[model samples]
Each structure stands twice: as C-alpha cells, then as structure tokens.
Target: MGLGCKMISLEPPILCRLPPTTPTSFRTKTIVFSSYAPDKGGGAVSTGLPKAHTYTASFKTLGACKLGISWYPDFEYNAQGGTGAGTGSKVADDANELSVDFDIETLYIPPLTSSTTKFLGLPLPTFLKIDIVPQLFQGNINQESGKVDLEFLAKFCFSVGSVYKAPALLVKTVLTSDESKGKIRGGRGERLDEEGNCKLVGVAFVEPIHDFFMDSFLT
Candidate 1:
C-alpha cells in the first residue's frame, strides 16, 4: 500500500466596517464587532467601528435683535431622547442616514437678570425681570450633516417685582440651522458641530394678544 499526501489551503478572514447600531432598549449592547487586519509587521490591527452617540447643544444665539429692540444672553439646551421623544433613527433608505427628534419640556430657563439679560448691549433695568416658560421644543437633527430644524414655542412673562405682572407673550418660531426669512424679520443659524455647539436663529411673528397690557405694550 502506498501512502498519499494531501495539502489544504486556508483563506484569510475578511474585514469590514459596520455602521453604528441604534439601541433598542435602555440596555446598552456591543453593537459592533472589531475588524482586524494584518499590519506591516504581521500584527493584527483594528479599524474601529462607529458607535451610537448623543449630543447636548449649547446655544450661542437664542435671542433676537431688531430696530434697536433686542433680547440678549444665550442659553443652553440639552437634547436627549425620552418618554415623548424619538431616539436617532435612519431617515432614508441609506444606512448612513440618521436623524434624532427632541421633545424637551422639563428644563427651565434661568431667571432673567440685568447681569445676564441685556438690551441694545445695555444691562436691563434691575427692577424689570422676565420669566421664560418653555411649552414645547420639538425638533429634528440630521446626525451626519449636522443640520437642525426645530419648532419652538414658549411664553415670556414680564414682571415688575411684586407690583405687576403682565400676560405671557406667546412666542413661537421655526428655528433652523439655515436662513430663516420672514416678512418683517429674518435670521440665520449655524450647523451643529462636533462639540454640540451651534447658533439657532429664527424669525417670529408677534401676533396681537387680547390682553390689554400686551396690546398696549405692543402698540
């Protein structure tokens, strides 16, 4: 009987980069498996996969300035997914497209003060103060392109200490990272950056309210 020798060929493993996976539940999972490739020294090296991320925006332009009437001092708003809001999801059929919705209502704006709030770059009168109550802040952010467009609705209540308080001014606008044009007023916004900082600008039309105080003030 003659003994026969046979040779076997083994193929190298394939390496690929995968997109980040959306978290299905509160639990975090390892969404990506590391892909390894041989280096010049024949040692395996990993080309890391993308991971899901969240962003908190620090607004640089939160107020308006027009005809010497201005509202100054920027504010910070953190955008996160919660009970009524939707988390990031792929918007288009393309796997790389992702968009996140923000419906924030719990956070309150810091009390307005002369030191913080200014008019025409001059400090507001110490006796005068305003309270901002956010009713709804819903928006969509394109993750890849850094574009942001939001519908903001809030009430600005003016007060003069314990003496008097006026009816809330219902302020509503479509804030965006692009130019916001209106018949009387317009603004421009900046796109979200890597550090989650951007300037959101909007043009709001002030509708006449039935309240005597508000009407008188506007007129």
Candidate 2:
C-alpha cells in the first residue's frame, strides 16, 4: 500500500461553518404558521430546539497505507460534524487506485430524526451532507506546488419543514458544492496521507429518509 492506493473513510462535510439563517415565510415558508409572541418580536421556540450543534465522531480502519485491515476495511471515518468529519483529511497520490473493504454507516444522529418508532420499521425525517477535499498533484495546502490540485465541495440536503413548528411537506432537498482544498502544498498538509491512493472514502446517509409531516404539509 502507498499514497496511490490508501483507503480513507468518507463522511459528512459542511460548508461555511455557520447555521442555517434563511428566514421561513410565515405565510409560505412556515408550514403550521406561528404568530408574533405578543410584544416579544423574537419569541424563542422550543427549549429543546438545537442551537445548531456540531461535534466530531470517529471509527477505526486497519491501515493508513500499504497494508489495510482485513475485516475492518481500509475505509475508516477520520472525523466530521459528529459523523466522523473531524478525524482529519486524507490525500492519495493515485486518485483511482484507492479501494476499501466495507460498507458505510451514519456516524451521528442528525438534529432531525432518521425515522420514528413505527410498526413498519419506518425511518424518521433527517438530513445529510458530505464534503470532499482532494489535493491533486501538488497535494499540499501550505506550499505552492503546481503538481497537485485541491478540489472540494459539499452535497447537502435537509428534510424541509423539519422545524418543530413547521408543517412538514414535500421531501424537499437543497444541494450545493464548494472548494475545500486550494493551493496544493508538497502534499496534503495537516491532512493525512495513506498507503497507495486515497479517495476520502465516500458519503452515506446511513439514517433513513422519511416524511413525518406529510398530512398538512404534503397536502
């Protein structure tokens, strides 16, 4: 195994380390609709309302390069916004050479539920996103190398109207991509380098996607 054929777990990646700020239209944006809380123009919502929380979660992989874990698989989630998106970055010399030996799983419980405890084993509502940063030739973020090119983007989407007060409607989804890696250094800096090649693993929404507020919103 070498830089050209290393396995790295891929997981949720975020954009603009900030929380959603778009205001929902009271008439249209909001599902159930909420009125002003008396004189309190900014009446707070539920106390359990998550203040846009984020954390790092991790799993194990047998090898970084050369040799890989037999049963564990080479793809190990380094870190993420709770879903193993934090462990760090992975860079490989050969882009198409990296391979793994396992399936993917959700590393965190999204603020939204993946599903409800139903008789049909139905999944709850939830959201998922993944960010990928790759250092092409230069493979360095600190150095100005032309050998590697860094490219990154995040595929994000959330179940619309998942807000506690909102009347969940259609299974709405919004996605966008951005650049996470730029200025290729000698190799991925703080980012790690495994054996053979690396592909930052792959993204998975382990949690099932469901529609809880289908009656009022979907109608």
Best by TM-score: 1
Q: What C-alpha lDDT does candidate 2 achieve relative to the native structure?
A: 0.21
lDDT of 2 by residue, 24-138 (tens): 0000000010112223346656666334322122322222211111111122222212221221122345322211111123222223233311112333334422222221111
lDDT of 2 at 163: 41
Candidate 1: misplaced stretches above 4 Å? 1-87, 92-105
Clashes of 1: 0
What does the lDDT read for residue 91 in candidate 1? 51
Q: How high is the lDDT of residue 197 in model 1?
A: 42
**Candidate 1 lDDT tens digits, 20-94:** 100000100001111223245656545686433443322221222111111322221111111123234545554
Q: Which ten residues in a row have the lowest lDDT in candidate 2?
A: 22-31
| Candidate 2 global Cα RMSD | 22.8
Clashes of 2: 38
Query: Could you tell me the lDDT of residue 72 within candidate 1?
Result: 20
TM-score of each: 0.57, 0.20
